[model samples]
Target: MSTVFVVGSLNIDQNIRVRSLPRAGETVRGSDATFSPGGKGGNQAVAAARAGATVKFTGAVGDDAHGRRILEVLSEASIDAGHVRVSGTAATGTAVIAVDDHGENQIIVSPGANSGITAADVDAGLAAVQAGDVLVLQLEIPTALVRQAARTAKGRGAFVILNAAPAPRQIDGLLDDVDLLVVNEQEIQVLAGLAGMPGNHRDLVQALPPALGPAIVCTAGAEGSFTVLDGSLVHVPAATVAARDTTGAGDTFVGYLAASLAGSHRDLPAAMIHATRASAIAVTRTGAMESIPWAHEIPASAPKPATPDPATPNTASPNTALSSPVVPN
Candidate 1:
């Protein structure tokens, strides 16, 4: 089994359920507030573990109660938290989230300890990654650390999966070191500027610089996901379900995708279907990490066709194809 190393952020999410999202300058009463373990990195780590991967989470948190609780949550999920550091100078990162009846959410983040991650910290985390392992990264922490981690993982021959969320001002060759670039329409737009528009899976893949990596996956909420796999355009439709909270859906998708790719050693298209189904399950519930489903909980509706043959080792050459796009099942 391939191990997953998550180098990112750890945050305590303060969430509240409201009848509807608040309007501009409108203060609306919400249900009792609750706190849960969250953050892009932490959520993806938990999601990957639940999806049946050996996950190691590396990030920083305060020595406070919130930090302790977050660590406890990761431990419960069977994620290795030994690499996570305790920062004395800053508090754990936090996210204030408001979820409406429609399952839509708005989030405001306060990057505290997450911003304190140093190059040394990233170096320590990268030590766990070996060739053929999967390294999951996000932008919740500092960009410099993200680059450092990317370089380290790439150097180690580990598969580098970058979830460029909360889109930075410049992707600026950040994708150069990444093996797989996962993002939504908005994020791709930010990373690629005008080229990233249209946001179609094929278009985004075509627009992205070849140096940014060989494969790209663009997710469009309920509309499903698009990707260029083996020179073909594959679209995986989202599973239908009642949504109670959409938070962490993207993280769920990314986590499951990484696990499927690492565990199954299948091509990008094969992994995407599994991820889309897992994400469909996530939005049906509330909370970030709480909403992510375990491997057994994934529905039968999510197609997992035998491709590249199950008997084959999960190892496949990366970015060896970019032919004309053929529509896949």
Candidate 2:
């Protein structure tokens, strides 16, 4: 099994449950309020650990309660947090989230300590990464740092995966360093400059200019996700369940995908299936890290030989979807 390294953000998510998303300046009241340990980096790291990967996270948080909580959560998930830093000058990062009845969510983030990550921070976090390892990145942190890590990981012969969320108006040269690029429909439309691309997943994915770069995975919520493997586009169906919150689905998918590829099952198509199932399970519950399913809880489609060593887990099948009843929202 290959190790998975993440260089990203760590935030305390302030979530509000509302009947529906409020329009601009509408001032709608939330039905309930809650807080959870979240952030693209932290969420993905937790997801990968739950998916049976040996994971390490690198980022910064404030010398505050939120920072302490974030570290505790990561430790409980068995993620290596040695690279996580505490900033003396800044407050911990935070995200104000609103989830509606349909499970859709809107988020407003305050970078805080997340914006303080320097190139040195990225380098320190990636020191443990080696050839055949998997490095996962996201846009919540500084783009330059993400680019630097990607280059470093690629030079070391490790696979680089980027989830370009909060799509930048213009993609930097970092695209060239990515081995796998993951995005949702809204992001693809903006990043690809095809806001009105009127076609199915196959056409949209195929139409992307080579400049977009990397093998792509385009997710379309309940419609499932699309990816290209072995020169063919494959669609992995999202598990059917009543969604409680969609906040962490994308992170779950990216984390599970990285975990799958880091193991013996390097097949992209099979990995996508596993990722999609993990995502489906995520949306069926509320919160981010708390929602991800553990490897033992998920049933794989094809049963591979089990490893005799308890420390190392065997690769599981990708065809099996989540069959358990939905937990109360």
TM-score of each: 0.89, 0.88
TM-score of 1: 0.89
Tens digits of lDDT, candidate 2, 1-329: 89999999999999999999999889888966788899999999999999999999999999999899999999999999998989999999999999999999999999999999999988888987788899999999988998999999988888889898878666758687887778898887776663444555555555553445576778888767775433334566667789999999999999998898888767666777788778877898999878888888676663222112232222322211111110001
The sequence of per-residue lDDT tens digits that candidate 1 reaches over residues 269-314 is 7678888888888998889988999999987765534233222333
Candidate 1 lDDT for residue 50 = 94
Worst 10 residues of 1 by lDDT: 320-329
Alpha-carbon RMSD of each model: 5.7, 8.8
Which residue runs of candidate 1 sit more than 4 Å off their true CA positions? 194-202, 209-211, 303-329
Please give the lDDT score for candidate 2.
0.81
lDDT of 1 at 151: 89
> What C-alpha root-mean-square deviation, in Å, does candidate 1 show against the real structure?
5.7
Which ranges in model 2 have alpha carbons more than 4 Å from their true place? 194-201, 301-329
| Reference-based lDDT, each prediction | 0.81, 0.81
